[model samples]
Target: MKRRHFIAAAIAAASLSGAYPALAETDQVRVGYIADFWGASATAVATEQGLWEKHGLDADTKVFTNGPLQIQALGTNSLDFGYIGPGALWLPASDKARVVAISSVGNSDRILAREGVTSLADLKGKKVAVPEGTSGDMLLGLALEAAGMSRDDLEIVTADPATVVSAFASGQVDGAAIWYPFVDVIRKANPGIVELAKNADFPQNQFPAAFVTNPATVTDRPELVGKFIAVMKEAGDWRHANPAETIKITADFLGVDAAVLEQEATMGTSFTAEDLAAKSKDGTINSWLDGMAAIYVKQGKLEKALPAADYYTADLFVK
Candidate 1:
C-alpha cells in the first residue's frame, strides 16, 4: 500500500512538466528554519540554489532559533513546513504536528563548561543552562544519565540556546549545552571555555533534524509535501557533491568563517536516501525515538509516550 502510494505521488509530482521540473507554481510557503546552525546545511544549499522554486515552491524562509519555536509555529498553523530536532517534539505540542522527513543526523551540538569545570561529572550541583525540550536539552539529559545523575542532580536552568550562551557569559550558569555556530560564538569570546562533551562523544545523544508539518498540511496537500522532500533530497545530494560550495554558502548564511563551517561539516552525518533506507530497514530511528520518549516521560514533560510513528514519517521521502 505504501509503495503504491509513493509511486502514485511521485508520478503526479513528475508528470507536471518533467522529472523534477525547475518551475514555480505556488505562492510563498512560510518555512520556519534555524538561521544559526541546526539544519543550516540543507537550508543553505536548498535555498541558495533555488531547489524549492525548482520544485514549484516559493519558500518564504523565516528564521527561528530552535526547534521549540519552530514546532510551536507548526501547532498554530503559522508555518507550512520547517526543521526541528527530536527534542522539539518531546513537548505536548508534538501532538499537533508530524515529521515528514528526516534530513540529517550528526554531532552538531556540544557541552560548554566554564574554565574550572572540565568534565560532565564536574557539572554536578552547579547551575546548568539548557534550552529545555530541545535536542541540546536532551543531550544534556543523556549525558547526565550516563554520569549516574539526573536533571535534578544539577540546578537545571531553562532558556533558549542564544540566551543560554548569554547566561553563561554573565556568570549565571556554571555550564551550558549548545550547538554550533553558537558553540563557535562561545569559543571565540572566551578561549578559556572547555568542551565537556559533544554529540559524537556520547552514544545515546545521536541527534536528528527533521522537517515537520501540521497534520492538516500533510492531509490537505500531500503532493506539495512530497515536492518539498524531493527538493530537500536534491539539496542533500548537492551538498554532498559540492561540499566546498555548500560550506561557503552555509558560512555566509550563519556569518561564520568558511573554516569554522568546514570544521563543523565533519562533525555530523547527513542523511541520504541510502542512509535513511538502512536506518528504516533496521527500525533504527523508531527505536531511538522510543527510548527518547521513555526518557521524556520519565522526566514528566510529556503526558504519555507518543508512538515513534506518530512523530515521524518517511512516506514522502521513500522514493
Candidate 2:
C-alpha cells in the first residue's frame, strides 16, 4: 500500500479503538449511614478501596445520626441508598415510601447501664437514652418486656449515639442503648458499671441493618443497585481480612479513636450475598422483623403488623 493509504488505515483503526464501548459510567449513588458504625465503616472501605468504582458505581456516601433523617432523604430522592435497622423501614414504608433491604450489616445493640445496675430489672425508674423509633429503642422495648417491665418503667430520653456517653457521665441518663464504639466508651469509662444484654435474650441479634434503596431507584437503576451490593460485599470481605486497617480508616472518617472502631467492629458480623440469600429464605430475617414489630405493637409504637417481609428482597442477593 502507498504511505498515505497506510497512514489513513492506521488513523481509521485508532478512531475505531477510541469509539469502542467502555464501561458505562454509573450515575451517582448517594449512600447514607450513621458515622463510625459498621455501616459507615463499610461505606468508608468501599470508597477508600475503590470497590464501588471497580464495580462500575460512583458512590457518594452521606452520614446521618438517625434513620428518620436518612429515610427522609431517600423519600426526597436526595439519597439513593442507606443503612438502617430493618425495623426503622416500617415508618417510611407506611407513608408510601418503598425500601428493599439487600443485606444484613450488623446486629444486637447492647443496653449499657451505669454502675450498680446488675440486670434489666435494675433499669426500672432509671433514665435510659436511646434514639427513639430506632432498632436500639425496639431492642430496649424487647429487653424491658423480657424483664416484665416497660418503657413506662424508666425515663426514656432520646439522644444521638455520639452524645450517649456524656449523657451518662453527666447523669442526664442512667443508661443508654447504643451500638459499638459508643458502648465501648461507656464500658471503658464505667468498667463494671455497664452491663450488656446478650444477643440470645432478644430477637435483636438477627435484626437486619441493611443496605436499603427506594423502590423507584431500585426499579429504575437495577444495575446500579446490583453493582452497589457487589461492591458492598467486596468491602465486607476486605473488612474481615483487614480488621485493624478497616478500624483505622473508619476511625479517621468518624474522627474517633481506632480503639473505638475496633470495639465496634468486633460487635457484629458482615455478610455476603450467599449469606443474605440463605437468611432471607429461611424466614430468619422475617421472623426477626416480626418479633421486633410485636414489641413495637405492644409498646404502642406500632399500631399493627406492618408486613415486614415486603421490605426486603432476597433476589437482590441472587446475582
Candidate 3:
C-alpha cells in the first residue's frame, strides 16, 4: 500500500509539475540516480525529452546523492531502475537489482588537490574528502595504493559530493578524489589543483556505468524491458548525433558551465543494443563485473568474494 501510494504521488506530482507529458495511461516507473552528475546523462536526456513516455512508461526519477543509497533503495523495491557506478551493486552482494544495459559512459575522476599539496605521499595524516560507494571512493583507494600509501595514512573523510568542494576550499579536507562536474567546482575555486591520477590510469576496473533494474520487472514484464532498452538506444543515438545539444542539456540539468562539462564529460566507447546483446552472450561484460566484484572484496567493502553473476544478470541485456 505504501509503495502504491508513493508511485501514485510520484505520478500526480510529475504530471502536476509539468516536468513531462506522455500520451496515455501506462505503468509508472521510478528511476534513481545521483543528483547533478552526468555519468547517466542518457537517463537525464531521455527523461527530459519525454522519451520514456513515448515508449509507454510514465517515468519519474528519484535523486540520490550516491549509488549505494540507490542500490539499497532497490532492495526495498522503491526504485524500478537506477543509473550508478557498478561498484555499489557489488557491495551489498544481494540479488535485488539487475543491469539491463549500459546507459552511457563518461570518465570523471581526478585526485584534486590545492596548490601546496603535491602528491598522495604529501597527504599523509592530511584529510581528504570523498563520497562513499561511488567511483571516487573506489579510485581514492587505488590512487593511494599507486602512491604506496593507503587510507590509513590519510584521514579519509566521507562527505557528500555537494559539500566536498566547500570542505576543500575551507581547508577541512586537504584534497578530494571525486568525479565531475563536482571536480569542476573544485577546479573553479582552486585553479592550481592537479590530477594525481585519472580514470585512464586504472585500467583494471573498466569503470563501467550502467542501467540497473528491479529483477521482477524483467521476469514479469519482458516487453516493458524491451521498451526501456529502446529508450536507451534512442537517447544514445541522440547523444552521438547531437553532441552540442547533449552538452547543453546535460550542463543545464547539472547547473554547470558547458565549458567545464565538455572538459570532464568524455563519453568513452558506448554500447549499442546489438553490442550489449553480443557482449552479454559472450560473457564479456560479465568478466568486467566479476573483476569489479573481486576489487570490492580486496578493498574490504565486501566480506567475501561474490560472483558478478550474483550481483547482476545479463539475461535482460541478452533477451
Candidate 4:
C-alpha cells in the first residue's frame, strides 16, 4: 500500500474506535526535545502553527537537557515522540525501542574556544564542556582525533548546553563543543573565542537528527505516527518559506535575541519527508549510523555491533 494511504487509513480506523482522539479530547500528545538551537523552536512552530492539533495530536512538549534523557522517556512510553541524535538511537534500539527519522531539524555544530587557542592542539590540559555520550560529544571526539588528540588529551566536562555559555564566560571551561545560537551567544560574550570545527569538517557530514517513537507505538498506532510525520512536514515547509518569521518565533520561544536566532537559522538545513527518504535510500543516513555504531563499540559502550540501517525505518517517510 502507498505510505500516505496506509497512514490515512490507520488514522481513520483509530479515530472511529475512539483510540486516538483529537487534541481537544486530551491535554496533549507529549513530545520531548533538547533545548539547543532549532530543536525546541521546531517543536514550538509545530505547536504554534496548529500542525499537531490538525493531525489529531496535541502539543505537549517537554524540554530535556540531553538525548539520553529524551531516549529514556521514549523507552518508558512517557513521550509519544521525541527528537534525538543518530548516535543515541543505537543503545535504545538494542533495548527494543523503535525510532524513526521524521525529518531533519538542523546542522549547526561548532568547537568554540577562548582567545589564544587557535587549534585543537592548543586545547591541551584545557577543560572542554560537552554533553557526554551525545552526538555533539562524538563530533568533539572526531574533531579531537583529527587534531591527533583524544579525550585523554583534555579535561572533558559534562554540562547543559545553556549553562555552557555561562561556563565559558566564567572560566568554568576553557572551550565548549556546541551548536549555533549558543555559539553565537558565546562569541558575543567572549569576542576573542574561536570556532575550530563544524559539521563540514566531519566525515560524510555524519550528523543525523531524528524524531523517534517506541516500537509498540509504531506497531499499535501506526496512523498516529504517520499523522505526526505529516504535521512535522507541515512545520518544515512553513519554516522554509518564512525564514525570518521562523527565526523570530524560535528566538522568542528560546528567550534568546533575534539576531542570534537569525544567525543560527541561516546555518540550519531544514528537510522534508521527501528529502529524508532520498537520503535514507541512498545510504546517506546509514553511513552516519554505521560510523556512530563503530565509535560506540570502540568506546566499549556497545558489546555487539549493530546493523546500522536496521536502527531506522524509512518506510514511514515513503508514500
Give the candidate number with the greatest lDDT: 1
Candidate 1: where are CA atoms >4 Å away?
Answer: 1-24, 91-94
Evaluated against the true structure, the overall lDDT of model 3 is 0.69
For candidate 4, the per-residue lDDT at 148 reads 84
> Model 2, range 1-319, lDDT digits (tens) per residue?
1111111121222220121122367667788877655657778787777676677777767777767778788888899888776447556335334445444445547788877778878777878988777767777877787788878888888876656666775667888887655565666556666665645466444665666777777678777777776777677667766778888887676665566566657767666545666777787666766665565567777577667666555566555
Angstrom error at residue 96, model 4: 6.0
Per residue, candidate 1 scores C-alpha lDDT tens digits across 1-319 of: 0111111121222221123555457656877776544366687777788787788888777767677788778778788888887666575233767777777776777778989776788887899888777777877877776678877778888876667767776678888887765676667656789887767766754566778888887788888788787777777777767777888887676555677566657766776656775776577877766766777776566778778777666555674
RMSD of 4: 9.8
**What's model 4's lDDT at 261?**
60
Error of 2 at 153 (Å): 1.8
Q: Spell out the clash pairs found in candidate 3.
A: none
Residue-level lDDT tens digits of model 4 in 1-319: 1111111121222221122324433335678776555666667677667667766776677777667777778777788888776446556546555556644534677888889888999989989998676766767877887888888889988876666767787778898987766676677678888888887786554566777778787788777777777667667667766777777776566554576566766665777556776877887776766666777666557787667556566677553
Candidate 4's C-alpha runs over 4 A off are: 1-28, 86-96, 298-300
Each prediction's TM-score versus the true structure: 0.84, 0.81, 0.84, 0.83
Q: lDDT tens string, model 3, 95-179?
A: 6567777654446777887787778888888888888778888888778878888789988888767667777766678889788
Query: In model 4, what is the error at residue 233, expressed in angstroms?
Result: 1.9
